[model samples]
Target: MLDELRNDPVILSYLQERANLTKGKIAEKLNIDTDIHTVCVHHFDYIDTLRMMMFYLFQQIGLNVVFYIPFNPNAPDVYKTWREIYERVSGCDYSRWECVESSQPNRGTKFAQYLDKCFPHQEDQLDNIRFLSFNHPTEFKEYLQKNPIVNNQNEVIASYEKDLNIYTDCTKSDHFYASRYGKFFLSLQNCKKTEDGIFLTYDDYVNMMTSGWVQYGSINGTQALTLLVDLRDYMDGVESFQNIMERLQSLVYLQEVSQVFDEVAKEQAGRHRLKCYLSNPFRCFPYVHQSRYQITVKQLIECTKDLARKVNRLLLAEREKKNVQLYLRELYKIYLTVKDKWEPSAKQKIEKLFSIHIPDHWEFAKEELYQLLTFYLGSTEEQENKILNFDQLIGKTLSAENIHVTGLSFKTFPWKTPELPSLLTHTWLKECIRCSFIATNQNIRINALLVDYYSRNVTRSTALYSIYHLLAYGNGQITFSYIKDLQENDGPSIYFMILEELYNKEKVNLEEQTEEFSWEETVTTQEEIPKEPLRNIPDLLWLDSDFCQRKFFLNAFVEHHPVYENDFHQQQAFSIIGKLLAEQGEGEELFRETMFPLFPQWTNAHKQNLLDTSYSSGLRTYK
Candidate 1:
């Protein structure tokens, strides 16, 4: 029979067209099936073969052919057609013929019989099935008061829906919703609303049947089943669906990019290749087709470009950080080489260190380098024996009174090098000055070095402002002289700015001391005073120089008065003026002159109270 079917041109063409198989392949498959006891026939491909001939051949070969028919007992036409097929195939061989019925109760009569047997006392079986099918747990329980049998078909469906809900409810279960729902719920939560309708996603029906939850059947011993179920409703617009899909795709792409970045960050070779790969837009758009991702081609391009830009920035910053560390390591090596010898060769190496161009992001490296150089320069005792002047050796002209160093001119000093200004900023200079001051025991040498360096650097104003507070730590005579020179050269405004900063720092120290000893007596004699000066006066007579002291008091009073608008600067100014007045014992005169003229609104009582408190042992009036 198989040979005849393969030779007939009409049958061969029909089989090829219907089964998508060649005549030779169909004949081969048929011959193979003949030796088997059971034969499987595709329900859809039944029409492609002569059914009677196939069945007769199966019987002749003592083989049984199985047909998985989707039975619908309620429809007469469907029932009649299947019955006719069965009768025609069975023929007159009643002895060999058989009919196997599915165990499921399909018809109402069969279902009634099942309910009667399983739940004999149940009267509302119909209502129970309806309630369970619609997921109305409340209605199902109410109907169960009269009792109902557990019908196989309805119970299987109810169990499936229950398990599905438990699985999709991410709050309860950790199942991968994307694998079950077609798309992740987190991405779906960002869905937009529109007027027409809320569009829905296409659920992965194939995954549902194969999911372990369904394949393992119900825990209650219910039969396993597979059915096309619409788990989610479509209430969003098409645009919303597309938007959600695009967002999901973007999230997936970003995760991939992050993984690549992490890998690149781990290896130098990977980082070198990152820039080239980052520039290519297609690298982030690996899954760009509509079938795999619903995003449009234009959107995919835009997203890739945005991701590439962001990733490139991250890579650039990473590279800059790495470069900064490398430069700092090189600078440290040069410092070590020149630590002991201050010879011409060592100076040439130091000159090369400063000659390299500094990138802005390497500000930390620049700071560290300046600190290292300052420490090394200050530590070496050979400078006095070298015969170079302080100016030539340090590349800055200083007052002879500031630092009397005797060192011969070192021709290899990097004074002639062009990148000196680029190597130093206001911050770097400040750090250098601090290191030098500490190393030299708050000597005028550091101040003079800074004064000379700032005179040559374009950032003199900023540099001066940064180190202004350091003057308070210097000797009284030198501080007074420096203030006098700054007032004369940079005008009274810059001088006043310096005074404000100095007094502000002093005020904070005074307040902290007061709080520490506030429990002591309200009044103590000047000599009995905690032996610690009320404040370490960097220049006791600096403020006693009537002209400078009076001018600063007046400026502070006018700017920080209560009637005047208050801000952080005003509060700071107020604290500075209060501390100076209380500590200097000159508040009585200043208030009578400066305070009275500024605000005449004060009464006699207010003036007397202010004077008494300012001259008291502690800052009673300020608090």
Candidate 2:
């Protein structure tokens, strides 16, 4: 029958694929009636029919077979298969086969116990059962004690230590374990302690190999952090420095490991002790939290300095361009982490680090230095001194032709300092204005400095252009005293520039105030000021003090330009003057004395009436 079944293609394929046997092998095994004493069956989804058929064949041949079926009350098909197998095997002669029942519902432990019960008298048969089991820890402990790896206690301890040393060595050297032998050896080392000694069990070994740490022999910094975080969740308290370091060094880069150490030191209680341990590993100490691990401000600053030096060395080497940026950013982050812990003495070191220059990499380096300086030397005095020092340094290095102050804005340097303008050379000032004009957040300060630069070094076309550029874009409040000073010292060009601006502004305001008035229509009727330059104009006339100089400029303005002698221009000019004089409490005699010579066409009655009308609450008019 078996030979006939082998000729069937379905049976042949099932034997080859599922049972891992050829037709001839299956036939050979089927012919051996007495050789098969105890057959163990494990569940496989595809080979369920094959397994059942094989069990039925074995039962018909009066072979003792034990099927390890896991108890799943939720799975009715599994229970149905078990019942079928039980009925089929039990229906055979009861003397040749035996069915063992497990009292416990947990199928994990039941399989092993049921196997021992099925082959109680045959020690060799039980040994040859060769099945895997999942049992409780207590049951595994019982099995370990019954079957010890070593007969005595000393050998057990020796074996444990030997294996532990091997694991420690492998971890230290970052050695990859062998596929088969290493796994088996690790299993042996995963033994549980007993009253007599330590004993190995299949379940304990499996659990150890599957633990989060041992699952992956090697890990990186991020992975190590994940494992540490997981352990933090499971463990009750902080782990020891030795334990933490061993795991971290085995997994991550040495620098990353040091960073992790620093992180742990920040949160844990034994920071000083951990620091000492990391510094000198030869000294031995127990795993206890020591409260004396205080990190001083000076020590933190020195540590940050060391990191900065490392970054500097990388920069000096000019290799690892990618790592250079990354390390520089990280170094700055570390500085920020401990920035508040800076001592006064650490300023020199920080400044020294800041002074190191890397060509083409000066932007980020300057940014980091700016941040550090802002944090450490935050006082106004210290910042001033540092700015002066930087200015002197910059002045020495600044060239005549190529003045590329790209990153030197007000935020980067103290551009607003009064001394900065004096300390920097004229060439540097030009470059600073050019760079600061575009990059500064506070344009008012930059504009003020430009004005200062104009006052001192007015010869530079760049300074003049900077001042004019500021005025153009400065939102039209040209109220800086420097503008008046420019008018006094430089010439009337600034005065005319301001007057032109004010004229255009007043026209716009009048147009806005009176929507009925058209600017283009008014321009045709109003007299145009002649383009000839007006000379001998007093400087005080441009002053904004009490509108006195402005009124004076207006009077001088119409007198100098005869084309502006029309009634509209004269009335507008004299009306403003009358209002000013009335507000100043000047009598009509004074008004006549001040203005009749300026305006000879006006009668005394007309001038006094203009004055009286200007004093009225309503708008003043002239006939």
Candidate 3:
């Protein structure tokens, strides 16, 4: 029968012609077994392209085919034939049969009102023709046989109504009526009243399936319970079905939804289920896409944890690969630079060059130093940690001035260099002794030994000279005061006491010399002057001196000042000399500490002839 329908030109033509009309109405009256031979394709709108493909496949596979056209509006005497079919087959139900219209008028127009006010003019003409055509039974029979046309007497299904098998007694089971009656009840309630009739439509059928009406059997507890449980089970299945249906609906509405939502959902679900094992680039764990996950919530959490570990491992491997590549490039450059000149003996030289001796007090071992250097190299990452550890061990040790040496003898000093002569490298004759005084981190502790003699009324020059002599020969670290308590009973001698302890360790013989300076001992240069009584001295000076001797002691005092104060004194003294130089104006050479000529040359006449007198500026006196 399927082959017959496919090959039959008459049936194909009819099917093709009526394709535009709603298949529901056509299939309703047609005496056709829909399961055996399909006349109307279900969901054809969605699968038109698919159907075309299938049609070609069938053709390729040698199936008989024809293009169908059943309900052609331009057929000969279509209005007459349609009216006859509607009147007889539709059983005078004008609501069920649509009127044959020609040149439909717009609503609210005079022609539309006229057409709507009375019946269609085409309908009268159709009715007249229908009466004439079907008047003879022989002609109608011929029409049915020749046209493969369905006629009035054929047993057809009623599209609109279902017969309810009403149970007079409540015990009779009724599934269809229970399912459908609620829809009918609601439809009757919702429909607008019209003078002609009720338009009980297909939307009412859809409401029966979707609304909660079909959920219950009856008011009786037993039936209601059974019905509800079944409905619930059915609804659960229906919900899953609804998901698929909604996705399909989206395809129809794709133009409106932008298609991305469907793509995203599909991609998410697909990627989730796809399992993969990783391959290298690196010998690490597999990296999988998390979006394609389809596991349950608990499983998803576990999967995420696993994925994180895998991703971390992969990242580590990639980092190693990058490091290897970088190393390889560096190795190639090294090969280019040193390949020909490289020697096995060079290893010893390289090792020796890199070796360094850490200070005795410093606590780092060789391995520790290597680690420290490694940490320094890793300054790209753990810089703060490295710096913190380094600070903990050393913490600016060189920043101190009064560094008291304890273990090493003052006599055993580090290597002395002529290039950099310093009292620090000089060894005292005994164990730890007085060292040159410098700032202990710039926190001043005034040494009283330098000023003790001055306080006792010894000459300032003599005291200063002694202090300078001690500083130039001293060794080890010097200890001194950081604060001066002028109000203390110690009388500013505490700083000096600290120095005296260092001086005692140095084996210095501070025996006083009773003999005064002789002319030969005092005079070393042509410009030397004789010492005189030092008047206007506070109860501090123990000697008298001329300007030259006083100036020599002052210069010594400047050098013996604490190291930290050196910069300060230098700046202050320079400022004073600079002012003096500026007053003197431009000259042949600039003034400096040692090289510059001091005093102005003066030509003087005593009685008959003028003579040149040489005088020196006292700038070096404060050096």
Per-residue lDDT tens digits of candidate 1, residues 153-219? 1011110123222222122222223232212222222222234323333332112222221211111
TM-scores across all candidates?
Answer: 0.17, 0.16, 0.12
Candidate lDDT values, in order: 0.32, 0.33, 0.27
Candidate 1: regions farther than 4 A off: 1-85, 88-155, 158-623
- What ranking emerges by lDDT with the best candidate at the front? 2, 1, 3
Q: Model 3, range 220-313, lDDT digits (tens) per residue? A: 1122222222223112222222232332232223222323333545644454311111111010100112122222223322322332232232
TM-score of 1: 0.17
Report how far residue 108 has shifted in candidate 2, in Å: 24
Higher TM-score: candidate 2 or 3? 2
Better of 1 and 2 by TM-score: 1
User: What's the candidate order when arranged by decreasing TM-score?
Assistant: 1, 2, 3
Please write out the lDDT profile of model 2 over residues 390-449, one tens digit for every residue: 222212222211111111111222123233434666456556657766644334334433
- List clashing residue pairs in candidate 1: 197-236, 198-235, 198-236, 198-237, 199-236, 199-237, 387-407, 387-408, 388-407, 388-408
CA lDDT, candidate 2, residue 528: 82
The C-alpha local distance difference test score for the whole of candidate 2 amounts to 0.33
Judged by lDDT against the true structure, how good is candidate 3?
0.27
